[model samples]
Target: MKQWLHLSAVAVFLTLLSVFPVLAQEEDEIDLSQIMKAAEKKSLSGGGFLEFQPSLIGLNRDSFFYQLNFGDQGPKRVGQYDFRVRLEGSYEKRTVGLYFTGDGLLRKGFQGWDSRARLFEGYLSLRLNPRFTLDAGKKTTKWGKGYAWNPVAFVDRPKDPEDLLEALEGFYVVSADITRSFQGPLKTLAFTPVLLPVLENLNSSFGKPGHLNFAGKVYFLLWNTDIDFLFLTGESRTTRFGFDFSRNLKSNLEIHAEWAWLTDLERIETSQDGRLSTTVSDEMSALVGLRYLTASETNFIAEYYHNGAGFGQRESEAIFEQAKSPSAVPGSRTGNSADAVFPPLLGIPNPMRDYLYFRTSQKEPFDILYFTPEFTSIFNLDDGSCQLIPGLTYSPQTNLLMRLRGIFLVGSEHTEFGEKQSNYRVEFRVRYFF
Candidate 1:
């Protein structure tokens, strides 16, 4: 039954692709404005992208992560191939709308071939009036103002620093949006409330099972500034409250910040002697950033983040020591659990106290149309480690894009970036949009 359903979905997707060009041609021959107006009331649109990436990675065999992952003996270099497909569509009929995004990936790596498929987002929305809307199903409520990091995104997954703008997989949720407009200093006001349930087979990765989480966000646009206050509370996780704001200082300069405070957050740490300890305390996380566009079309972004819940330098070094210990066992009581050590270090990127992010991108440099060059740096203030990335992007055609990039990790021993499994990597990617 599942196989038949999958095949039927593929057939429908192909039919939509085949129909789009015909509809485009017909619209070009008619009154486009009138057609557009009518189509807005009842429309179905679908599009997505295909991408291929090849990467060469240089291993850091002496690092703790390398030993934990590959054991004593590991390769010096690895070649990997990655292929991805995204299929997204939306259907709207008056006040009712349906939207979905599906992703599929195939990877050829040192471990051999692997493939996976996922529905990143599939949601149904209802607009009762111009000012109120409701949504149910899997959705991403991107509520933070930070670009590289969003400490205040209480209901959303953490963003990947390397791919900050990438679409994230969302959790099952029931949510609503209410908006109001004013004529005075406060021009706009909006509120969003979300209810998320975690069950044995649904949204299990979110937190503890059998709990319903409640979260909400209130927005205010006042005096040309955008501000938001948000909170989350439930049995699944600690209660937290946060706020974010964004403002344009000038035509070419903008600034944003996010702050979150978590009450009684639980943290686990490992001692150098391989003893595990847990702590519960109040914690705060914050990020402040700015974006500046120069006259030469060079865009610069800088951010500073302080993660009060993260491990300090000494704590991180102890964890590294535990991972490197030859006698470390998963189930041992005296020694730290191998399971606990690896997940905190590898699963969470930049699990340190302080960080600095800087990125600069030049658009169409030297009059080379559709070509851009960029550089990014993420520095760990606590451990004095950093990752540097330089890349170039070019769009040779309207539907195609090419990107080439190199990533290098720099740090001394016992530092965050220095102990990464990979010392450096180079990758080339090609993507096509439908």
Candidate 2:
């Protein structure tokens, strides 16, 4: 039954793509003035996307994460299906606006069926004037200028490096934005301040309960360069200060950098003998990146990131060795304790001290309109581990998209990627907006 459902979905996707050109041609003939009028008259608007994705993964039986997760009863290969729907709506009245977005997801894999639903963002905004606006409820700050990583996004949730553009869940906060424009070398300036409160059953995932967090950002557009200074402090987490800048060196080349200082951050480490230890110290993290576009319309982005809070090479090796020990039993008391200490170091995105990211994409290759083929790589400099992803995306018609991608993990023993549960994965995604 599951196989049949998968085949049916593929057939439907192919049918839609095959007939999209005809539908698009008809849409292009619609009168633009009428569409504009419709938009102008609408104060309430809603739209969302429905997605279907199927994935195949090849497992690595010798990997540490695999043993920790499915020690004895795991499969060598796994096939999975996922479905997701996202809905966003907005209502505007003169100076006040309300916006909400939510998503639901369902997945079936080697384990079983799993499903979840949550509100990604829902906020109310009041614009006092052209220069100032206040917002309340749940929202995402989306700070920083880096394409893959944002070291200075202190108030926003961390982005997944594997799918950097995917929307992330937001936090509950009250915030405000104030802006100023000028004609001199400083073209624009803006300030944003945010307050986040954590309590039981609300934002418990963020940090410790019963704490109010404060964060802010000041931005300046000076000499055609974008600069920002940001800070976050509260009892829920350690205090941090960050700075970031971005500028274009040439018509086709741009550069960006971010630096952050964390005060008295805490970390936990496990030894080869399964003993856990904790350490606290001040740390600094930084990232530098560049984007270049060639004459052929191929775009390239590369970045080097240093994560001060991540595990060192020796620390990672010890953890991997512990997993490989014959007496190690996942879910046992010892394993549970080790697991608690591992995520802060090993479970985060780019969970290593030093890493490199590179991506390139060609737009509309071979005169194929609305199509792009891209390749991305994230390399861990500390352990020589890396992930390579090659993908193709196509927009057959307005608000309709399709993507196919493959992920390959490469690493040696005791390396970051080498100990992952899967060595390779292939996935296909289709989404339709309405």
CA lDDT of each candidate? 0.89, 0.89
lDDT (Cα, 0-100) at 104 in candidate 2: 99
Clashes of each: 0, 0
- Alpha-carbon TM-score of each model against the true structure: 0.88, 0.89
TM-score (C-alpha, index-matched) for candidate 2 = 0.89
Candidate 1, 158: how far from true, in Å?
1.2
lDDT score at residue 364, model 1, on the 0-100 scale: 100
lDDT of 2: 0.89
Clashing pairs in 1: none
Q: Native-vs-model 1 lDDT?
A: 0.89
Instruction: Please write out the lDDT profile of model 2 over residues 76-116, one tens digit for every residue.
Output: 99999999999999999999999999999999989899999
Q: What is the lDDT of residue 47 in candidate 1?
A: 91
lDDT, candidate 1, 150-217, per-residue tens: 88888888888888878999999999999999999999999999999999999898888999999999
